[model samples]
Target: MPIAPKHLKFDDGSVTIIGVDCATQSSKVGLALGSMSKGLLTIDKAMKVGKSGSIANVVSSWIRENSTTKTLIAMDSPLGWPIKLGEELIGHTAGSSLSTEAHQMFRRRTDFFIKEQANKQSLDVGADRIARTAHAALRLIDEIKEQVGMSIPLAWNSELRHPISVIEVYPAVTLKSCRLLSATSYKKESNGAREQIVDGLSEFMTLPEADKQSIIDDDDILDAVACVLAGSHFINNESVGPATTEDSALAEKEGWIWARMPR
Candidate 1:
């Protein structure tokens, strides 16, 4: 993959941090705008996003309905998807990886880049890509403004006056955080793990008042979204996990193995 331009502007509008999780039937969103005084992230708005991804109207309707503009969007989709879109929005070829194939290409190039960078500077090649992306875009942003409609950031966060961040979270994080150890364990017991779907829905509805009994079964999409959210949170500074370090090496006579590379 080609490297980004050295002197490119990434920020153009008031940025906002938006966290998205395509929950159950709805896309649950959590947005944090940089405080005017602090310029740090904070939860200022939220919503349950839904979309009909037809064509050019894939993401704009939701943005229009929500009146979300002048804010950079941060999604949890693999960087390749939105990277291409971001480039296209500005009418250019994205320098980042292009597709799943590009990700595989990254695998081939990782060693080269790692050796080159490590030889030059003794820095860890496995440093957080998302955070680095966020920071670098903020520092060197220079893109001609073109109308874009997608759930990804066209402009970097730093350029915005009141920047907002959008992160895609995952539900498994929520379930795990809720202490749902094993799905089977929860199902056979009397606790509340079985209620995860409802619990998540309740949250989606702001724990709606005068609740009528409704049925909920699985949480596939919800869990996926929650995972996105969790992954996003971990990417952002909001989640600083001091989780214990444990080494579990099924280290076979293999080429390589990286168990839980630090976030």
Candidate 2:
């Protein structure tokens, strides 16, 4: 028998969505503003955060500007490290043998789950350059919380009505789920792949012609828009979450990547 669909009960009329394609350097970080109202999603703006030296300032300014609307910040970066890596490193010496295997220590449960469901594996935060991006993401969250004067928690439920909430998103998995271009393909020199991706995305959200061209010109901008679509899947209760209690427990510490199931 087929399984029944599960959905989060979100009843709000409208909400602002910000998709952040985070990077270690502020110049490479991309930000996109979007909105969902009465079941329609629209992309309002997209741009690089610029060489402002601080991504928090740009994001905080946007938040302050849209203070009246509930906002969801979907970031394209890991928010936490592997739970096993943290647990196994406690009180360890330089030459001590680790209890957990290297693969398990480097990957979180959510990483494995995404691979199993979407066939798209996220980078290992414990042993990759992406670790720096992950650190930046966490620090950015803390800085934003301090600047905004609000508790910006990692949202687990779609119906979370907090004034400001954040969630980790993987644009690659989202693109795969939507049958668009692969993440690496669109970042190449040619803009053909990106144009195709924008065309595919237009079926779901309203994208201005100028913004669509901007997204095609920059991979970071495209990923930021994809992040918004992933967040939309979460809000519409189409994205997968932790299925087991142990998965949930690990996700609480290691963070979860919000994306739709494989097509």
Candidate 3:
């Protein structure tokens, strides 16, 4: 069967609500513009590459394919980096994540931790998937900001819902944020099929500007799209928890961090 179908109208929207996610092994893109729901998101594709150049390509392709969504891309990474890096890339870190470091936000949200668990079984911290995923998003955030001048959430404010406009999400440091983005989905072992998503995000982040030659993963974009949809969900629903308070995270059935949200 096919990994990603052509397209399905999920929700009806004046603006095409879209979300994007990045993972270690694969990438996911979601679209929530016009259908039955507020926003419709779905996985676009997945790929296998190891750096920024390849990930950007994946994103560009997806955007081109779904360019009609009046596209507003929601990404699941830090979008910006440290001062030194941010200034160079014209990006800054999202400030809200500090409330919860691993707050679940998008594919990267659960993805980072899921792979953290898998890291023990796959790439180990020395080559851990979570860090790698975060790094991949961070790198992409830098590149996208440099070229597109986007990504990076502002301070959290309830009035605006997420304190950021268009780009919505808590900073990566917030407690179990209610998102589904993470770079942990892909793992690098044996046939090296896991890291495919991560590599795809890297390529998409760079895009036509950098032009890196890495494999692509549509799943990364889909996951990022998930994060975006969730962000819009939080804004419209206003139930993502106090835009100013910390979230409640719970461990998995196995006694590990399974999921969390603002309480």
lDDT of each: 0.30, 0.85, 0.34
Per-residue error at 228 for model 3, in Å?
A: 4.7
Model 3 per-residue lDDT tens digits across residues 90-142: 44365523332222212222234444532312122122354565566556545
Q: List model 1 lDDT by residue over 131-219, tens digit each.
A: 34323322222111112322233321233333223332223333444344345543333435546554653442232222212112223
TM-score of each: 0.33, 0.92, 0.36
User: lDDT, candidate 2, residue 55?
Assistant: 75
TM-score of candidate 3 on Cα atoms, chains taken together: 0.36
Best by TM-score: 2
Best by the lDDT measure? 2
Pairs that collide, model 2: none
What is the lDDT, from 0 to 100, of the residue 260 in candidate 2? Answer: 92
* lDDT (Cα) of model 3: 0.34
Q: What is residue 44's positional error in candidate 2, in angstroms?
A: 0.6
Candidate 2, residue 52: how far the Cα is off, in Å: 3.1
**Where does the lowest 10-residue lDDT sum fall in candidate 2?**
1-10
